[model samples]
Target chain A: MTALAESRRRPWILRRRTRRIVPVAILAAVFVFPFAVMLFTAFKTPGDVFSTPPALLPREWTLDNFAEAFDQIPFWRYLANTLFVSGMSVLGTIVSCPLVAYATAKVRWRGARPLLGAVLLTMMLPPQVTLIPVFLIWNGLGAVGTYLPLIVPAFLGTPFLIFMIRQFMVSVPDELIEAARIDGASEFRTYAQIVLPIARPAIVTAAVFQFVWSWTDFLNPLIYLGDPDQYTLSIGLYSFFGENDVAWGPLMAACVMFTLPAVAIFLVGQRFFIGGVSAGALK
Target chain B: MRMTTIRRRRALTGLAFAAPFLMGFAIFIAYPIGASAFYSFTDFNLFQSPDWVGLQNYERLAQDSSFWKALANTFVLTATGVPLSIGIGIAGAHLLNLPVRGQPLFRALVYLPTIVPVVVGGYLWRWMLNSQYGFINYFLGLLGITGPGWLVQPEWTKPAIVLMTLWTVGGTMIIYLAALKDVPGELYEAAEIDGAGPFSRFLHITWPTISPVTLFQVIVNVIAWLQIFTQPYLLAQTRLNNASSGPGESMLTYAMYLFQNAFSFLKMGYASAMAWILFLLTLAVTLVILIGSRRWVHDGAR
Candidate 1:
C-alpha cells in the first residue's frame, strides 16, 4: 500500500514540476527568444547573418554593424527629429487633454455630455476615413513635410487620452474644487493648482503614451514628412531597409537602435504603461 | 436672474476649457469625416477638380476584384487572428498568474515587444522569417521540419503576418493579467476544496469572471486586425518606390489597398469610398459583438 501511494505521489510531483517549468519556458521562448536573436544578429558580422545554418550567437560579435548603420543613415539627425516631434506631441497632449477632460468631468455644462459622446465616437472612426481630408487640409496649408500636421493635432487633444484623463478626473472629490473656490481660486487656478496635482498619475500616463505614439508613428510621418532631413527614426529605418535590403546586420543594428528608447521608456514607466492600457480598455 | 447669470458664467467657463479640443475635433475629426463622405461621392484626383459622381465610386468598388480580394483577406485575418490572439493572451495571463518566482520580470519581458515600433518589429520579423537565412526555419530544421518560404508564398503569407502580429499580443496579455488579478481568491479556494481540477476551476469560475474583459479585448482586437496594414505592408512592400502587392497580392490587406488607392494610385475618390465602407463594416462588427456578448458575458453583479 505504501509503495502504491508513493508511486502515485511521484507522478503528481512530476506533473506539478512540469507544469511550473513548461509555462515559464514557453513564455521565455516566445516572448524573449526573438529579442535575443535580434541582439545577436545586431552584433554578428555580415557573413554570419546570412550563413546557411544561422548561428544563434555570433561567431564574431563586433560593433561594425552599429558603426556601419550610423555611417549609412543620419542616425543622430533622425533621433533628434524624433525627439523634437515626440516632445512637442507629449507637451501638446498633456496640456490640452487634461483641460478638455476637466471640463467634461468636473464642470456641469449642457454641451459636456455631447462633447464626451463625440470623443468616444471619434475613437471608433477609422483614421483612414479622415486621412484624405486632413492630408488635403495640411497640403492646402503647405504644412506637409513640416511637423505642423503631426504636432498641431496633438495639441487639440486626442480622444483616447481625453477620455482617460476624464475618467481619472471624475473620481476627484467635488469638495476639493469647492474648497478651492471658497479659497478665492479662479476656475483655471483651481484646475492648474488643485486638479492637476491630484491627477498627476493619469497625466503621466497620457504623456508616456503620447510620447511613445509620436515616436513610433509611421503612417503620419510616411505621409507628411517628405523631406529626408525631417525624417524620424521610423521613416529613416524604412529608407534604410530600402537602400540596404540585403544588409541584415546593419539593418538589425539600426532596428535595435530605433527600438531602444521606447523600450527604456517602457521599462522606466512600466507601471503607468500597464495602468494606461487597463484604463483604456476597462473604462 | 442672479442664478441665471451664474449658470451662464459656469457654461462659459466650461466652453473655454473645452475650446481647444472642440476646435480640433471640428477641424480634424468632424470636418474630415464629413469631407471624406462627400469626397467618396465625387471624383477628386489631386490634380483635378472634384466632379460630383454619385454612387460611381461605390459602383466601381462592387466590380473591383482587388477590392473584393482585399476585403476577403481582411475578413480572414480578423476572423482567425482576433480569436487566436485573445486565446494566446488569456493563456499567457494564466501562465503569468501561476505562483512563479519572477512574475513581474516575465510580465515585463512579454510586454517588451509591444514598445518596439511596429516598423522595427515588422523588419525584424521579415528578417527572422527569411526562408534561407532566417533563424525560424533554421530552428525548425533541427527537428527535421522544412518551413515554407513565409513571405514568398501566397498561401503562407497571411499566416506569417498573423504570426508577426501575435508578437505584440503582450498588450492584450497585460490587460488579461489585470483582469486575472481582480478574480477573487476565495472562489478558487472553494473550488479547490471541492476537489475541482485546475482546468475545471478555470472553466467554472475564472472564465466567467473575466468574460467581460474577453469581450472588450475581442472588439479591440477585431478593430485592430480589420485595420491591419504595417506588418503586411512592410513584409510585402520592401522596395521603396514599388507599389505592387506581394506574391499574388496575398498580403494586400484592406487598409493597404486603400492606401494604394489614395496615395499610390491617386484614386482618392475610390479610396474614400473604400474608407466609408470600412467604417460601416467596423461598426457592423462592433455592433454584432456588443449585441452578441449579452449571451455569454457575465457581469459580476448578476
Candidate 2:
C-alpha cells in the first residue's frame, strides 16, 4: 500500500516538472529564434547571407550592413519624421479621446446611444471605402503631402479609442464623480482631476496602442505624404524595396531598425498591453 | 420642473463632451462617405469637375473583368484566411490558458508578431520566402524536397499572403484569452465530474461561453479582409508593377484595385463607385452574420 502511494506521487511530480520545463524551453525558442536570425543577418556580408548553410553568426561580424542601411536612405530624417507624426498623433488621441469617452459613459445625453452606435458603425466601413473621398477632401484644402492629414484625425478622437476608454470609464465608482460634483467642481475639472487619474491604466493602454498604430501606419503616409523628404520609416522602407533591387542584407537591417522603437515600447508596457487589447472582448 | 432642467443641462454637457468626436465624424467620416456616394454617379478625374455620368461607372463595373477578378480574390482570401486565423487564435489562447508555468512569457512570445510593424513583418517574410537563398527554401531542401517559388508564381501568391497573415492572429488571440478567463470555472469542473471527454467539454462548456467573442472576431475579420491592401499591394508593387498586384491578376485584391484607381490612375469617380460597392457588400455580409449570430451567440451576461 505504501509503495503504491509513493509510486503515484512520483509520477505526478515528474509530470508537473516536465510540464514546467517543456513550455519554457519551447517559448524561449519561439521568441528568440527570429530575433537571433534577424540580428545575425544584419551583420552578414551579402555573399555570406546568400551562401548555402548560412552562417549562424556572420563569417565576419561587422557594422558594414548598418552603415550601408544608413547610406541607402536618409535614415535619421525618416526616423525623425516617423517620430514627429506618431508622437503628435499619440498626444492628440490622449487629449481628446478620454474626455469624449467619459461623457459617453457617465453623463446622461439624448443622442448618446445613437452616437456610440454610429462610432461602432465606422469600424464596419472599410477605410478604403473613404480613401478617395478623404484624398479629395485633403487635396481641396491643399493639405496633401503634409502631416496635417495624418495627425489631425487624432485630435477628433478615434472611435476605437473612445470605445476602449468608455469601457474603462464605466467601471469608475459613481461616488467619486458625485463627491466632486458636490464640491462644485466643474465637469471638465472633475474629468481632469478625478477621472483622468483614475483611468491611468486605460490611458497608458490607449497611448501605447495609438503610438504603435501611428508609427506603423503605412497606408495613410503612403497616400498623403508624397514627398520623399517627408516620408515616415514605413514609407522609407517601402521605397528602399521599390527603388533598389534586392539588397537583402541592408534591407533586413533597416527593417530591424524601424521595428525597434515599437518593440521597446511594447516590452516596457507589457503589463498594461493585454488589458487594452482585451477590452473589446469584454464588451 | 427642476429635475427636467437638470436633465436638459446634462444633455447639453453630454453634447459638449462629444463635440470633438462629432466634428471629426462629420468632417472626416460622414462628409467623405457622403461625398463618395455622390461621386459614384459622376465621371470625375482628379484634375477637373466631375461630369454627371449617372450610373455609367456602376454599369462599367459589371462588365469589367478585372473588377470581378479582384472581387473574387478578396472573397477567397477572406473565406480561407479569416476562419483559419480565428481557429489558430482560439486554439493558441486555450493552450496559453492552461495552468502551465511560464505562461506570461509564452503569452508575450505569441503576441510578439503583433508589436512588429506590418511593414517590417512583410519585408521579413519577403526575404524568408525568396526563391534563392531564402530560409524556407533551404529548409525544404533538407527534406529532399524542392520548394516552389512562393511570391513569384501566380498560383502560389495568394497562399503566401494567407501564410503571412496567420503569423499575426496574436491580436485576436489575446482577446480570446480574456474571454476564456471570464468563463465560469464551475462549468468546467462540472464537465470533469461527468464522464465527458476533453472534446465534449470544449464543445459543451467552452464553445457556448466564448461564442460571442467568436462572432465578434468573425465579423471584424471579414470586414478587414474585404479591405485587404498592404500585403497584396506591396507584393504587387515590389515585384513587377501589375504582377505584384496579383499573380497575372490572381492577387489583385479589391482594396488594391480601389487604391490603384483612386491614387495611381487618379480615377476618383470610378474609385468612389468601387468604394460604395464594397460598402454595400460589407453591409450585406455583416447583416447576414448578425442575423446568423442570433442562433449561436449567447448574451448570458446581458
**Could you say which candidate leads in lDDT?**
1
What DockQ score does model 2 reach against the true complex? 0.59
Runs in model 1 with CA error above 4 Å? A1-22, A242-245, B241-243
Query: Candidate 2 residues B1-302, lDDT tens each?
Result: 99999989988898988888999888888998889999999999989999999999999999999899999999999999998988988877877776776788888878888888788777777777777777777778889989889887888888888877777887888899898998899988888998789899989888888998899899889988898888777655663223257458877999888877887787889999999999899989999999999999987888
Candidate 1 Cα lDDT to native:
0.89
lDDT at B56 for candidate 2? 97
Clashing residue pairs in candidate 2 are B236-B244, B236-B245, B246-B251
Worst 10 residues of 1 chain B by lDDT: B236-245
What is the DockQ for all candidates, taken in turn? 0.69, 0.59
Instruction: Encode model 1's per-residue lDDT on A102-144: one tens digit a residue.
Output: 9999988887899899889888888999999999999889888
iRMS of every model, one decimal?
1.3, 2.4
* CA lDDT of each prediction against the hidden true structure: 0.89, 0.84
Candidate number with greatest DockQ? 1
If you assessed candidate 2 against the hidden native complex, which CAPRI class would it receive?
Answer: medium
Clashing pairs in 1: none
